[model samples]
Target: MRSEPTDAERALWKLLRAKRFSGYKFKRQVPIDRYIVDFICFNHRLIIEADGSQHAENAYDEARDSYLSQQNFRMLRFWNNDILTNTEGVSEAIWTALQDETSTPSPQPLSRKGRGALEGAHNG
Candidate 1:
């Protein structure tokens, strides 16, 4: 997938790659559970998908997103056309989402120390 990215994917990759977007590292063609996502920021548990016309309101996409959501991963879908034509807007939207400043706060990572303390308290 890395070698043969769509025009839109290639364009977006430029912005997402090398931790250029707010210093968050994004991996391409990452396998999360059973699904392969276009771009994923592991630290944020965010998945970015670039889809073509066929994917508009696609049932498969919906199901896939549902599954990802259940697994505590946030999904963002963009039309291929939008990525190609409105690269800046797409990048800005992604940046905003990453910042967790949107209406819905993005998932924040749980610290291991906190998790362990909570677990110990519950067990006690």
Candidate 2:
């Protein structure tokens, strides 16, 4: 990860930091496995990414997302432009995702080995 955050990341961090967002704790530039996520809320198993044009249809990101999903992390990706311009809408979307718990299980950390074993058993 870069030492300096982009303008958009800085803006979003203001909204998410210090449990300011409805008491949900979020960490920035967090490492999960081999990938460094932009923002993450461990309590919700949620990962939020602020993407630039380079990330459009990115194969590496797709693969990374798949891997994280298998580990029970939900992804919410927003464009830098959108995050900067439509800040309220972006915040609303994140709030909706956080409140909608029916689709996701209670937050729990799963080790890589445990996730692989579960997938193997399911496939077998």
What is the per-residue lDDT of model 2 for residues 1-124, given as tens digits with 9 covering 90 to 100? 8899999899999999999999999999999989999999998888887777676556787778878878888877777777787777778878877886555523232222322112211110
User: What would the TM-scores of all predictions be?
Assistant: 0.77, 0.82
Each model's lDDT comes to: 0.66, 0.73
Indicate which candidate wins on lDDT: 2
Our model 2 lands, by Cα RMSD against the true structure, at 10.4
The window of 10 residues in a row where model 1 has the poorest summed lDDT is 115-124
Please tell me which predicted candidate would have the highest TM-score against the true structure: 2
For model 1, what is the C-alpha lDDT against the true structure? 0.66
Clashing pairs in model 2, backbone N/Cα/C closer than 3 A:
none
